[model samples]
Target chain A: MKELLNLFLTFARIGALTFGGGYAMLPILQRELVDQRKWVTEEELMDYFAIGQTTPGVIAVNTATFIGQKRKGTLGGAIATLGVVFPSIVIISIVAMFINNFADSVILQNAFAGIRVSVYVLILNAVLKLWKSAIVDKIGIIIFIAIFSLSIFTNLSPILFIVGAGLAGFIAKRQQGVVS
Target chain B: MIYLRLFYEFLQTGLFAVGGGLATLPFLYDISDRTGWFSYGQLADMIAISESTPGAIGVNMATYSGNMVAGIPGGIIATLGLITPSIVIIVIVAHFLNKFKTNEGVQGVFYGLRPASTALIAAAGFSVVLIDLVDFDLFRQTGSFIQLMNWRALFLAIVLYILANHIRATKQLHPVIFIAFAALVGIIFNFGLN
Candidate 1:
């Protein structure tokens, strides 16, 4: 019971603080869950991220559920997911009911502009750290460049890119004569 | 009845909004088209709110639409509905997660997936910088790439990067601190009001 409460608060902090989307949550998740709590390792978080991307529902919600379930079972998953979405339910409801031109507020825009830049820097650092862990050999580099290039140049959906990369890895590893 | 309808629609969205929050946009447009719960302009407003406010964009959006349609209870139901699929699906996936983790072929796929996910993140960060720090729309009028740059934003970004990465003492500073500082700077400096 105490552990469930802890999980809820942790995810609630994540949900309330996250400004942009799932991508922005990466740095926060790394800092709080990965670095501080040590609940999930960097690699596990990445795995959850990968699954979260391909799976249905919001990536953030899927990730929270995955980790929560891992921590305390079905009940944990429910609590964590509720924690994440709880803030949105409250904040957006207030805005939807009371604030008509909240988005048009210059002050809010400026603050978000600043927030966006900060988010970018945080994401950049996360990517740099991930590079060390995720990219190990030539094949990893090849996969990185392929998707990186495609993403920058095309408007194609990321699901296709990820699924294609998984297939490529599945085949390439087998052809390399070893599964290690 | 509306609440049930809200739940059903968002349940479908939860089941199909693959990739992330942004991927839900099309289904939302479709919802507006079919149900008239909200107008297209209102949907755009919701997006703007989602972008500027906290939490996941998709969740914020669900809350906004439901609140508009049927008040607070409706908002709660819609959100619950949007996330119900994930709870059911992910819990099931988690049950078999160990099997997938140990499988060699699955291992191979992840071997590829790791770097690919990293690239996806890198690519995403790159675009955020482009959109937040540069203005192509404003460039059309000025006709100069240099002028198109939001110099103040870039300067803040560089300062932040240095503070967060280069300085050992500041490197340990919490991200929320940086976020708070950025907001303070924005409010004080009047960023991007021109």
Candidate 2:
């Protein structure tokens, strides 16, 4: 029970404070979960992040669920997911009420102009970090380049690119006799 | 009828925007372009405000767009629509993650997703730069090489970019600090919307 409460409060705090969404949340998760709580090792957290990125959900929520399941099973996963989402639910509710004012506010407008640049920088750093982790082989690098070109140059939607890449991976695994 | 369309559109956005909130930008842009529900300029403003404030960028933008389209209910419905998949997926995965931890097909799908996710992020980053930083119309209308520039924003962006990269004690510098700094500059310079 204590562990479950702790999981909720900790994730709630993370959800509340974190801005700029999932990528920004990564280092914080490292500091809190890895450094302070010692809940998961750095290597494990990295693996979780890699999986978190590839999977079809929010990274923070996914991480919370992974950690929660690790700590206390399915119930814990539910609690942790709640904790992560609680902040957004509350914050967005309040913002929704006064959002028009927020949109017109001078201070916010200026702040955003600066923030826009930082967002780019943060994402660039995240890409570099993920690249170091994900692109381990010649084939991976080639796939990265091909996907990047397909996304940037052509008018193709990313979903097609993802499906095509998955087919490629499946084919490669079959050819290499790795999956069987 | 309209509400259903709105819900379905957002549902598609929620399911497929794999790289997170920013990846939803292009889809929203396309929606705006197709339906004429919102303008490109409004989308740009949404990006600006969404990036500046707190919470998930995708959710924030959805709320704003929804509010614009259908008031408070629209905002609520859209947000719910966007996050529903994440919630459902997390819950189901939590239930059975252990049995599937090392499955080869799962691993392959994840591996395939990595490059594609990167592509989505890169594409999002590119579109934002195109919309926010480059003022293509200034060149068309002014026909003057000098007036064709968004000099203030460009300068601010460059300076912020450099400072963000080089400042070694960066982790200690909260995002609010930079946000506040930018606000101060904008206030002093009166960097009003053009």
Candidate 3:
């Protein structure tokens, strides 16, 4: 019971405080769950994050489900899902209730304007970190730049780019005599 | 008809948007073009609010877009449609997660997925940059590449990069700190929410 409560509270805090969405919450999630609590390992968290990225819905929620299931069981998954989602439900509900006043406030607006720059920085940092992790070779590097340029330059759907990159990576690995 | 389309559109987005919330941007842009339910500006607003608030940016945007389409009911439907697939997948995966962890095919799928995820995220970053930082249309008016740059935003990005890399004393500083500081600066500079 204590462990379950701890799981709930930990995710509740994460869900409550994190801003700029999943990628931005990731480092903090690492620190809290893996570093501080010892609830999960760094390797596990990385794996979970990788899975969360590819899986459906919110990364935070998906991650929480994985962690929760790992820790407790089916119940844990449900609890952690609730934990991860509770904050958003509450916060968004409140915002929905009082959003007009919140939006009209001058100070709040200014703060959001400034926060936009910070978000830009955070996203840039995430891109760099993920790039270092995902791009393993010269071919991967070429694919990265090509996809980045194509996405920026053309109106092509990212779905096609994603498919193309995956194929390129698969072929590159096959040529190198490794699955990668 | 529009409501059903909205549900299916977001369902598709939720199903395919790997790499989390930002990955949904391109799909949102495509939806905007197809449905005309929201403009690019409105999408930008949704992004801003989605990023600034709690939960996933994708979910927040879904909720916001749904609200735009048909108010509260729309919001609920969109959010549910986006989440259902994930819920089902997690439950099934949880049942066999331990066994599947060592599965080679699963490993290969994930290996292939990494690059694709990166590509989607990179595209998202560029789209946001184009919408928020650069003014290509404005450049067409000036008829010069040099005149088209939003130098303030560029300088801001550079400054942030340096600060992020250099601020060691507060290496423990939460990103919310930086976000708050940037918000204050934007206010002072009169970036205006609009």
Candidate 4:
């Protein structure tokens, strides 16, 4: 029970602090789960991140479930997932209720405009950091450029791209093994 | 009935929207088209609110859309539906795939997925610039370069980018502070009024 509560509180804190999106949660997750609690090593955290990205659903939630399940079984997974999404449900519900009240206010509209621009900057910063870490090889660069162009230029579903890239990577690795 | 539909729809979204929160945008857009639960303009508003708020944007969006459809219970149901797949999948993986991390096939998938996720995020960032800073529709209608851009927004974005990158204190400050500061600037300048 204590372990379950701890998992809940720790993930709740991560959920509450994360802004922008799943990517922005990385630093906070590293600090609390890795540096402070030592729940998982840095490599394990990265593996969780990778798994989270590949899996369906929100990366943050997937990651929380993975960590929680690792720690305390299925119930722990539920608790952690609930903890992470709890803040979003509460905050968004309130905002939805009040949004129409202030929707027409010029001041609020302008304020949102500014906030939107800043949000863009925050996302760009995330992209820059991910780029440095993700684009490690020539194949990585090729995949990045290909997907980036396809995403920008076409209306293709991202699922297709992700699946195709995975298959390609798998085949390439197999070929290297055979050659070596 | 509405709650059931909401859960079912968002469950599909949860099961298919890979790569992270922003990856769900296309699915949300499809939902809006099919169900008419929310308008495109409202979808934009949801994105803004979700991006600025704490927690995953995907979760925030699910909650907002569900609440719009059927109030608080709807929100809870939809969110629960959305995450249900994740919880189930992760638990199964945890139990069955203890050695999955070191498995070459899994590693290869991740090898490809890492860059793919980065590309998706980059695409998302580019679209945000188009939506927030550059008015492509206006540009097409007016055929004027200056009229094409929300100059104030562009300027503010650049300034924030520089501050975030160069200023030590600003760099260390939480993102919420920048968001608050930008909100203040927007109100003071009456941005987007024109």
Give one digit per residue, the lDDT tens place, for model 4 in B22-135: 767766766776789987556656776888788999999999989999998999999998999999888887765658767788777777877877887677567656766677
Residue-wise lDDT of candidate 2 within B1-194, one digit each (tens)? 76777787777776666656666765786577567888765665566556566665676777778767887667767766766666566567656655546776766666666666666666656666667667778878877777666678678766765666676765456555665666677666666564
Best by DockQ: 4
lDDT of 1 at A95: 84
Clashing pairs in 1: none
**Per-residue lDDT value at B53 in model 3:** 80
lDDT of 3 by residue, A117-144 (tens): 6666776776777778776766667777
User: Given candidate 1, what's the lDDT at residue A33?
Assistant: 96
DockQ of predicted candidate 4: 0.61
Interface RMSD of candidate 2, in Å, is: 3.5
> TM-score for the second chain in candidate 1?
0.60
Where does the lowest 10-residue lDDT sum fall in candidate 3 chain B?
B104-113
Lowest lDDT 10-residue stretch of candidate 4 chain A? A114-123
Candidate 3: stretches off by over 4 Å: A1-14, A17-50, A53-56, A67-83, A96-113, A167-180, B1-3, B39-48, B142-147, B170-172
Cα misplacement distance, residue A177 of candidate 3 (Å):
4.4
DockQ of each: 0.46, 0.36, 0.42, 0.61
Per-residue C-alpha lDDT of model 1 across residues B157-194, encoded as one tens digit per residue: 89999999999989987666787788778877887474
- Tell me how far the alpha carbon of residue A85 in candidate 2 is from the true structure, in angstroms, after superposition: 2.3
- The window of 10 residues in a row where model 1 chain A has the poorest summed lDDT is A96-105
lDDT of 3 by residue, B1-194 (tens): 76787789888877767667776777787777777888765566566666768777777777777777876667767766666566667767767766667765555445555656676676766676677667788789988887576666577667777778876764456565666667767778766533
- Candidate 3 backbone collisions, by pair: A114-B182, A114-B183, A115-B183
lDDT of 2 by residue, A90-173 (tens): 665566567567777876666556556555555565566667766667767778888777766777666677778777776665
Q: Where in model 4 is the C-alpha error above 4 Å? A: A1-14, A17-55, A70-72, B1-5, B16-48, B96-98, B140-142
